[model samples]
Target: MAEPQPYESALDAIPGAHPYPRSSRYHDAEVGIHTQPDGTAVRYVKRRLLPPLGEADEDIATHTVSSGERPDHLGQRCFGDPAAWWRIADANPVLDPRELTAEPGEEIALPDGFPGGGGRFGR
Candidate 1:
């Protein structure tokens, strides 16, 4: 059997790339290197914006819903408006509104249509 190749850290994988400056709010930014088997290397920078704590917490709540849970139910429970299901559906572009349903361990975006807007539950 062939021995498994050792995994390389992101920093080791890329050359001439350093961690983002501390002054930058996005600490997760890093340089990524892609190399061909023959050793030709290409470097690229990647940056990710971490979500706020509130959004993170809400995402956790969204993940707790079961696969069978209805989208309307999610809207009602999270936003206090069952009709706001459309907003939730809209935010989750990955899922189709006509087939909105949560799967186990899936995180869904919470709808932000709070009463005064023209959104589903808007006044």
Candidate 2:
């Protein structure tokens, strides 16, 4: 198996709140596959199956960053799920949420509300 890539970990009140940015791709797939020469009569190259990324998301709300805040905190405040901080990160595509949070007034865009009904949304 190929070595795993490291990603930034999210800190929060809950466990497993942070998911690996790109996870289990290598170990979850096959590699070093050898095929018979005369390929047409033998096996074929491998291609990984990918899940659909889904449709575009509309903006639900905009937030003004406040001092000493973290992505997880904003996530909990906005979506009731601290783990959902990635949603905030994904929407803005910023390199660092900590910088945004420390900026103390930077406007951040929040993704659209969750499609399904209930208190749950994009967590």
Q: In terms of TM-score, which candidate is strongest?
A: 2
In terms of lDDT, the poorest run of 10 residues in model 1 is 114-123
Tell me the lDDT of model 1 at 121. Answer: 27
Task: Give the lDDT of residue 83 in candidate 2.
Answer: 68
- After the best TM-score superposition of candidate 1, give how far the Cα of residue 43 lies from its true spot, in angstroms: 54
Candidate 2 has its poorest 10 consecutive residues by lDDT at 19-28
Model 2, residue 21: displacement in angstroms? 13
Clash counts per candidate, in order, are: 1, 0
lDDT of 2 by residue, 34-119 (tens): 55676644423355443223333443456787788898887777667676676666556467866647678888766664221112
Query: What lDDT score is found at residue 68 in candidate 2?
Result: 83
Q: Quick one: RMSD of model 1?
A: 16.9
- Taking every candidate in turn, the Cα RMSD to the unseen true structure, in Å, is 16.9, 11.9
Give the CA lDDT, 0 to 100, for residue 44 in model 2: 30
What would you estimate as the lDDT of candidate 2? 0.52
What is the C-alpha local distance difference test score of candidate 1? 0.49
